[model samples]
Target: MSKIAVIAGSLYLWLSPGLTMGQRTSGLIGVPDTSFTVHSAYSKAKKTHPDIRIAAPALPPTVQANLNVVYCNQNGRDLHIDAFYPVNQSTNRNQLPAVLLIHGGGWRSGDRSQQIPMAQQLATNGYVAVTAEYRLSTEALYPAAVHDLKAAIRWLRTNAREYNIDPDRIAILGCSAGGQLAALLGTTGNRKELEGTSCHTEQSSAVQAIVDVDGVLAFIHPESGEGDDSRSTSAATYWFGASKTEKPKLWHEASALTYVDKSTPPILFLNSSVDRMHAGRDDMIGKLNALGIYSEVHTFADAPHPFWLFHPWFEPTVSYTVNFLNKVFSKK
Candidate 1:
């Protein structure tokens, strides 16, 4: 166990009591609601802190995390995976499963650090959680993010026993852009991507489950009403890299809904009313039902996207997520 991990774990446990009821339920209960406090804590702790807001508030033997663990170091640019897990043993389940997490920032500007509180809660609840980083749209687009996330999974699997993780039970969770990637991982299933280094190992990067928090499921949808705000055309243009009509075929293939086969992993979709991209989440849910995939969408009446990261506002959303996970994974 690293020193930083120990410190982070202690901090999370100490501050868990500060969370509101909703935050407590979700299991991610430590982030301060006030912007100033958050700003101060974030800056002071910075890369040294591990753990994200978490679920399973009652679970014990709390652990902290490290900001970035190098998975792929190449050309002076390192591809990292940040992790949160238990610091010591818990008799409930000595070894924890994993939630392979990714953050959201339109695939262009998000980092692994944002979800420390969430990851910590997941760890406390008997899960080894990782919030991974990959190349972004500005640096590289399309499959770059996919490949990096896939690589992170492979790394986790290879070292599962060391981390006390259940390799077969690893799941993927993402928010916003990250959620889109998680959806993609679910749709892609166990099939390996063609990119990345030829590491001479047959490790698998496919996920057993997915959690999509306000993701983009279909780039072009028949149900799309004119002038709807699922996204700005310019943002989509930058992301999709072609007009909807110009790249219709590619866009559909890339969408999570298009690839929702029977083998697709179970998905938990979290939607917020205020987000413009909520429609995409709905379309994905419809497809999940059509394909007989066990998918559930929890809609917040008017919650803003990703606001669950905050302490006060996120309490309920966090609880909802934990209960959903408990119900879904209990059978598996």
Candidate 2:
């Protein structure tokens, strides 16, 4: 019907033939109505929503309402993550699902600060939540980021007891570059090279679902029509130390869309109408649908690229994220 929808449908049509190793093409786009009016509605709702209020600061808060902080020194290099468990001061320390969160900053500059607050809120909501920090692109590239997240999952599993967490229920949450890392973990299962620097424990980083916050999907798909190359040298382009044209394979390998398999986790793509990178998220969703894998898309109104973190306290996204996680963890 529309440009974006047409592109999505066309891609679905191409992939409907199933997973065959070959080149498939679909060039269509539908521009849905994304207006500022919707954002105003969200902003208005945020003002009165009870959940919009952020819980106070905490070292590793047991509850978002209080101050309780904790950390882990598991992996070498003082590597660790912050956690928030139930603060009832009553229930056993073993009744919560753990969520591994990654922050986004162009794959080069984010910290757990982006996720800590939300994790703390989740912890308050009867789930054990963690905000982990991993090595950045400056230190490594391509699979390295994925490697670090896998290691974090392993560490959480190995120490689940001490942390009062449920390892099997762990899910990855991230935004932008962090979102890409989460999707990577969700799709790529156990690999020999990414073996987490451990011989004692074998923690499979297969998450139940992925929360992809405005993350890019395919690196190879250029816009169909004539346009400037804003896609070049993008937020994730140079991570491999290879030019876009020189390392075509590397580009595909790093793409989360390239690793979709039967074992890939159900994905929830949170997007906006203003950014092209995220605009292409529908492509990945279409691919997932063709494979019968679980996936959903939530397009934010009027928000532009680089705005997810702009208003960390923005109630609209916060509530939506919480609800999404709850559904992901539901028994149904």
Candidate 3:
């Protein structure tokens, strides 16, 4: 057998001892590739709000976009980031605050393009906004995606002058899985262990604020319903390369709640009616409150998990995000 096939076979055996070699191989290899895209999300959203439309990806007259700019190069894979900034920002005497937008696809799917419209809107609102591409579970794994995002943050700071960005005033915003990552990044900033040895090591990956849209804050909390494998290996399973029971420490380590401290930056939770999606949010907020840190929560009534992808919700999502960033970053 080829080396890859042999390895895959070993993985099957390791992942599921109960299954026969053939059954395990089929289960492992038959996993379908995720098809999480703007169109797909729109279709899902339209089922409930038929009149809702996908937000326009066009840049506003006052906004300028630099698409597909490579920000990190890892082992020949050039991760790209799309940057949107206000027109004439180059001439501005003051450095503009920036936000990096991360998309959600259960940490396995979705691309930077998913947040293009949000980036454009943020740019129009006078902030330098960037949507980053990170390695997904299919490409790498858990900490790999985290490392890629941190690299993107460092890259932004490294090029802050060129982008007219205030390195210290940056925020990170994400939806769903991306929101979980944004929250984790906010809490784990400057932690040497979580900081991957990727590009821009000299630059810090710390964010001044965080906006998490319907993302869970803990993978192993009592309020969390993650790691349900009754149907099949869950998204978290694929990302962690093991089940919660198999790698409890990994699950706890990835949870943002594990690293919450006084040094953690302000956070905003924009959630939908789906309670499980925002699991552990309240607990984390309570911790922040005890630490005297700033935090806000805005829940959309009866909204879909991917509400940010569609019309009515999209506009409000943008509004809330901008307002929260303004409130948090406006502070010293």
For 1-332, candidate 2 gives per-residue lDDT tens digits of 79999986765453222212232121111121122222343465465442333333454545733222222232233445776667663357444677888877666566765676667767766777778776554444455566667877776777777666666677788877787678777777675644445422466766777888877676666631112237654445435545456666766776777778777777887875545545346777777888888777777775554345435434455576667767877853
My TM-score estimates for the predictions, one after another, are 0.74, 0.71, 0.91
Residue 48, candidate 3: Cα error in Å is: 2.7
Tens-place lDDT digits, model 1, residues 79-160: 7778788776434455577888887766656577766667777777767888787765444435556667777888888877
**What is the number of backbone collisions in each predicted candidate, taken in the order shown?**
20, 10, 0
- How well does candidate 2 score on lDDT at residue 193? 46
Error of 3 at 98 (Å): 0.8
The most accurate candidate by TM-score is 3
- lDDT by candidate, in order shown: 0.64, 0.61, 0.85
Candidate 2 error regions (>4 Å): 1-76, 88-90, 193-201, 223-235, 310-313
Per-residue lDDT over 8-121 for candidate 3, one digit per residue giving the tens place of the 0 to 100 score = 776644433233112112224424346888788888878887888887767799998898899987656789999999999999999999999999998878888889999999
Candidate 2 whole-model C-alpha lDDT, 0 to 1: 0.61
Better of 1 and 3 by lDDT: 3
